[model samples]
Target chain A: MTSETPIIVLVRPQLGENIGKCARAMLNFGLTELRMVAPRDGWPNPSAGPAAAGADSVLDQAKIYDTTAEAVADCSHVYATTVRLREDTKRVVTPEEAATEVFNQAGRSAFLFGREASGLDVQDVAMANAILTVPINPEFGSLNLAQAVILCAYEWSKTQSLSQPTLTEQLPPAPQQDLDGLIGHLEAMLEPKGYFLPDSRADATRRTLRNVLTKPGWNHLEVRTLRGVLSTLAKRDRK
Target chain B: MTSETPIIVLVRPQLGENIGKCARAMLNFGLTELRMVAPRDGWPNPSAGPAAAGADSVLDQAKIYDTTAEAVADCSHVYATTVRLREDTKRVVTPEEAATEVFNQAGRSAFLFGREASGLDVQDVAMANAILTVPINPEFGSLNLAQAVILCAYEWSKTQSLSQPTLTEQLPPAPQQDLDGLIGHLEAMLEPKGYFLPDSRADATRRTLRNVLTKPGWNHLEVRTLRGVLSTLAKRDRK
Candidate 1:
């Protein structure tokens, strides 16, 4: 299924730094479209560049609108993000649920976020088809703008075919023969040191040692390096 | 299932602000215990407070250790967070998978985050039971300190019963009677306008209309509001 990314609309955001940070958060998850509804400090705020770190593309293509309605006018689905009490009745869904709906539906979706101090006005929320809220600490619901943006963006990204940051090709496990050789070398050294004492328990002790060594699923390179360490220790004992 | 919240250990972290932000990220998902290993600028850095915003309790109780081993000495399980190439053999798992394992195992777990620039070294990874990595963009794997902390914390929190930020007791769906009232009200207005034009397919058309209205699963207040809106539209037609 093609991923339907929603346009992020920041309604009257106060700081350029926060805008930049929000841009960084969006690009981190592959969301590009940004719409601003009457920014307090105005668009192209000089302070935003440095804060964005390197997400210049998001900041570069950010579109500004006069009002929330105009910003989301073209959207088939609009989710207003707010934590305050609403006077109008609207369906409330968590970020995860909203993201699922966004991906499932085929249309232009817009997520509307309110100003810094005071969130979206009643009219702004009424314009939205639904409300998206994050599961935050009720006692301290103090999520900043960028934090909120990242939470939503991250959830939506999970539904898409985004590449995992750390899933690179891994080396296969070492051959059993090589592992056994390394185990034998270690056992030979330990036998001289009397590390496995008590003839009655020697077999069980060796079995336990083998289990610990094999648990890591060491690759050939790791096995070689470990054997080298054991050889070095043995040579020191000879000295 | 009981959430075995992992102890976050910062190994040779450079900045106080980043440390504070990490604490904030941890608390955001209900992971509280934080241990710092040899902070460069020393503990209780003034810069951390403002950056942390209001996560004072986490910072106030932050523990400092001389080494990574000391920090995680008491923990039964240790996960090292890193994005670097390792020379050792260790099973690497994604944050989601690691979180699952963490919650399933019945013991104290510690997550170690390395310095901002270099990540965890070989020695640090060797100490860990497993490697925890986030799936990030290969081209730009520049996840800041707080971002990384929050990602793992959020994933782990999902396995727990921590109250969602927006899960205030919602009014159950509007009763079937109320929903029927809403459907009837809308149909009454549509009937006069001959919305069901073809007489033969009028029943099927009405069913389709009902299906659309019920899909949103509107609550009682939402249904009442829609009915009010319909009445207003009808009154305007009369005018």
Candidate 2:
């Protein structure tokens, strides 16, 4: 359930830049499998490298096929992405629902996306086991190829233990003793500025200030930075 | 809970195509409000129109600001979307967690995205009430501007009742009788084809066939189409 990544198939994609962007989106979520069926201008377009930003590995390994059927022939589950009216009676599911199914199902799965100007034709839709649609505004249902790929990729990524940029290894919170030192330093700087002016309410104001400062659970680096900022302000007054 | 949409503020976004693509992503998830803080190429960029596809309204109504502070001046809650190290100790939440908070908490919320190359500076992050980070591949956390925007917008839209392109006014499942007829038609076609050649296993095979056909919960149209396919196959042998 955690490691299975869906293969992205672009059906008759028009632009090289879009193909590169799709690769970028796929790599963002840890997906690397990409299949292209009949790219209009052919493969290895020079414009793709810069557009991909840095996801060139996905582009390098992308497989090309002559038709949609061949692209997804190995997949046990196939999902076609489109907003156009599907004449066939294929079961349609939102990207969220489709992602859940993809995670639960065994074997490789493929997500098919159509061309830029026009979507998958009737024959393409018929080949898919299901239709994956994003809930979009009716007035403006224009989703670019990368956007569509990303919506599905992001949803699928949620089911996996992908590392979040913020969740990566970070500095531990400063110990309570260090935090107290930081609070004391700030209070000392504010005391001479009349920040605790009224004696009657001074105790309560100090407590409130302490609560605000402690709420963030500042790591040592943050505490050090704030102390530096206070020292700079103090030095300005001396000048 | 459904109608609340977050304001997307791009602080110092470099490219017009990226801005246009951001609008396209926002509209795909029913988000309309977009604000820009000093885009490098300038507002009403000539290149944006083509990149946006048909999401012109989102681009048309997009507001511009000279600074991040003024862009989120009216927002009660502001979230800074960044992967950089912040000197300030702000509470960080993943996009999934942030989307839940945005739906539950009342008041207008804003998400600030930084430039493509450098990301949000310390000043921009300091203004935000909290930090929002997408769980991405750590080795390559290079999510472009539009990819970041879509990740947040898609997560937020999951909390709303935005009409899914597939979930809108679908036909109900066909009656059991209709499905039974479809199964019978296929069985009849298979009868003469030696599909059930071994008499001893014919009964078990029929039951297995029924189980596979009934799993999809096909609507009337699908049943009719399957039956049509069966009839065509039967006629093919006659011709």
Candidate 3:
């Protein structure tokens, strides 16, 4: 859950031209935060300058990261954009749904987009709490990166002033790092007890667990309580 | 008054690349009809092909006109797209209002866009029944030709059934009884640890915890997962 204007995170984006176009698209809809996870041509590319079409501020201020996880660590609500819905338990939300949620909820939200050739990897998708899918023309659904970014940005921009006046009284969900700590604690405990046995299914089991935990959108206080619960149970056993 | 799909008219557009981009943008939102009035480089421009990307169909079927008046000769409701509101009697409508009007009224509607450097001329403004403007960021309102075209196209697409499916997948919040059971389980576990020992404040602390837990409205699956987690921890302690 998040009330902050969502940031755009491009994961392993390929072209400098597309990156420039993305920056332009984002700025067009009043979005400024641009996080890139390992660009193919590297940052500060000459091709980007010409294509940005005067959105250099977004590009100039763009932050780069080595991995998707690190990029979204501060975000509380992370949305992964996918062309086609994968067979997963994660909830699928439209651009409008996501836009509305951002305004009414309480934490920082980030949208994730994969590279040019293929969309986000299975691992990257697992990292996101939900999937953001744009329903386009079934006959000819060909939305490029900039186009996709524009739609989400446009939807979000629409809600800035007009969002429901009533804000949720609930606390915002814990940041990604906090959730990671909780998940890590659970994994550590479950690991020695063979909860992740048959190493082949470990990755999938972990992803399923993540999807289940993420669905609750637990607040920091709740996360802390759960963490304390774990410690208490563990300490009792140790004694 | 127009109920038919709105047609896009590019008035004396200067660049073929921009024309191609407009075509791509239009096709993205399921808008197919594109009209160009006196393109600078002439018809069948080479640069347009690459920029159109996969929207060749829109370009192939595009109608060319000698003037803006001739372009909308067959249309009844004409809209002039301008960067600024003209000081005239014309009713200024947002892209969304224009889109809603397009679906509600009767007769053919056409949206007119001007050249790359300069927008629609006074004569072109006079031809329209209303002016369609996108309210963007005042600080940086530099929307390119294709970007402008896409925003209008995207708004128009919203009225159609194209976006109906993307909003149906999210599960509803779980029932109240499930929430109570999960809260009870957590409280029972925490009780042994003296979490609610102070008799006077115990009720208030429990209420706070309940409020935090209830805020998420976790679905049955999530509640069940929490129950399993509590059981797992408690069973471990006993072992």
Whose lDDT is greatest here? 3
Task: Put down candidate 1 lDDT per residue, B46-66, tens digits, no spaces.
Answer: 988887778888899899999
lDDT of 1 by residue, A1-239 (tens): 67578999999999999899999888887788999999998878998989898988889999999988899989999999986545557899888889899999988999999988898888888889998977666555667788788878887877777656455466777899989998898777666555566888889778766755565466676677556545543332111
**TM-scores (chain A) of the candidates:** 0.89, 0.65, 0.92
Ranking by DockQ: 3, 2, 1
Candidate 3: which stretches are off by over 4 Å? A1-3, A161-166, A237-239, B170-239
lDDT of 2 by residue, B112-227 (tens): 99998889988999899999988777776778788788888888887876465464465667899998998787666566555554899889778766755565466776567556
For residue A100, model 2's alpha carbon misses the true position, in angstroms, by: 1.3
- Interface RMSD of every predicted model, in angstroms: 33.6, 33.8, 3.8
Measured with C-alpha atoms, the lDDT of residue A55 in candidate 1 is 89
Can you give the lDDT of residue A100 in candidate 1?
92
The lDDT ranking, best first, is 3, 2, 1
State each model's CA lDDT, in order.
0.75, 0.77, 0.84
What's the C-alpha lDDT at position A65 in model 3? 95
How high is each candidate's TM-score?
Answer: 0.76, 0.75, 0.86
For each candidate, what's the DockQ? 0.07, 0.16, 0.38
